[model samples]
Target: MTAPVDIERARFNMIEQQIRPWDVLDLDVLGLLNEVKREEFVPPAHKALAFVDMEIPLLPDTDEALKNGHCMLPPKVEARLLQDLAPKAHEKVLEVGAGSGYMAALLASRAQRVITLELHPELARMARENLQQAGIRNVEVREADGSKGLAAEGPFDAILLSGSVHEVPQALLQQLKVGGRLAAIVGDLPVMRATFVTRTGEAGWETRQPWDIAAPRLAGFPEASRFHF
Candidate 1:
């Protein structure tokens, strides 16, 4: 059994070694990383991997795990995305994947309100329960496909794709408010870039690729088709 001090030390080491080295230098984001108990949102059997710098499967049953898109992004990736997005206190945020509700909880800590969408019913239910247990009140988990952003909750201040995508869906881009930012990891396996898109005007948008990292493809997103020449 792990002691409290051991867990705390591991958490500290994660921040100092994994997160900070990744250039996640935002003080607020760093502080929130410490404040939120990641271990609580992780599966009990994988609690020891809570601070590891790799994707941790959310489902206890390995066979149904990655297939369901139930996995937490590496701690550093989560922190870097949050820092880059810089969600404000008065902003409304949207998260595409709610694996364990951990990212939603992080966004909720900075934003006024957060709505996270999950495709799997069981995962959504678990996310809700985890958020409730964490005492996170401003996050709402919806069981729905996030390929197209939530239309009724349009004009979100910021949007986040908690997983990777072959390309950013136009439907989601249309949901962002002018000046709103959308962060997503885009590209195929072995090589993916973390990109940010900002709505500049009614018909204009700006995109940037700040870093490269690979993550599992978000479920329900359209896949590129093969064509014979």
Candidate 2:
């Protein structure tokens, strides 16, 4: 009896109402949000809740993350962080968690190339498919633990951590170009803040704390992660 949903209007409202009110008003960033369909990246079952202001499940428990019920963050948060990253034309951007490939797609729209890391192989494969479907040619999805960072793809122009960290790994800081910026949400739930660290020079990185928000924890990065003991 329910009507078939209108996906395009939902995407428009999601951008104008939920994400924009969260202080994500940059035209370029907003345009990217409009261009990328979050619903398309969502799993078939969760497609309906794609525009909702909460996390959505990607898989049903074939992985460790599914056992934990850790879903993707709200669209507004992604928009805000992407705005802070400010990736430029012809720059290489690195993303730690591929998730649904939403962030990677966003980066592909602005950057020359995106080297993204993913812990879950299923997620990585799905992301690759989504990117292909979306016609995003610049994103390369890989299966790897982000705790180690991407050593082989070092010296990137921009780095983005797809989830929150209690503290960013010192190793990740070393991977950026002298002028590149790394954007990530840092801290625990209910009080985390998104930060941007710009590599000012050798042995020095300028940091900025922008948003006091919360996102799912990055799978790897035990060095920057909190102590269980």
Specify the highest-TM-score model's number: 1
Q: What tens digits encode model 2's per-residue C-alpha lDDT throughout 1-229?
A: 4324587788888988998899887899988776787877988878889888877767875355543424577888888888889899989999998888988999889999999988888889989999999888989999998767787888999999988888898898999999999998887666888899999999999999966886778776553434677
Q: Which ten residues in a row have the lowest lDDT in candidate 1?
A: 60-69
- List residue ranges in candidate 2 displaced over 4 A: 1-5, 62-70, 223-229
Measured on C-alpha atoms, candidate 2 has an lDDT of 0.84
RMSD list, candidates in order: 1.7, 3.3
lDDT of candidates 1 onward, in order: 0.93, 0.84
187, model 1: CA deviation in Å? 0.4
Q: Which tens-of-lDDT digit does each residue in 22-120 have in candidate 1?
A: 999999999999999999899888988999988888877765676655799999999999999999999999999999999999999999999999998
TM-score of 2: 0.91
Q: Which numbered prediction scores highest in lDDT against the true structure?
A: 1
lDDT of candidate 1 at residue 22, scale 0 to 100: 94
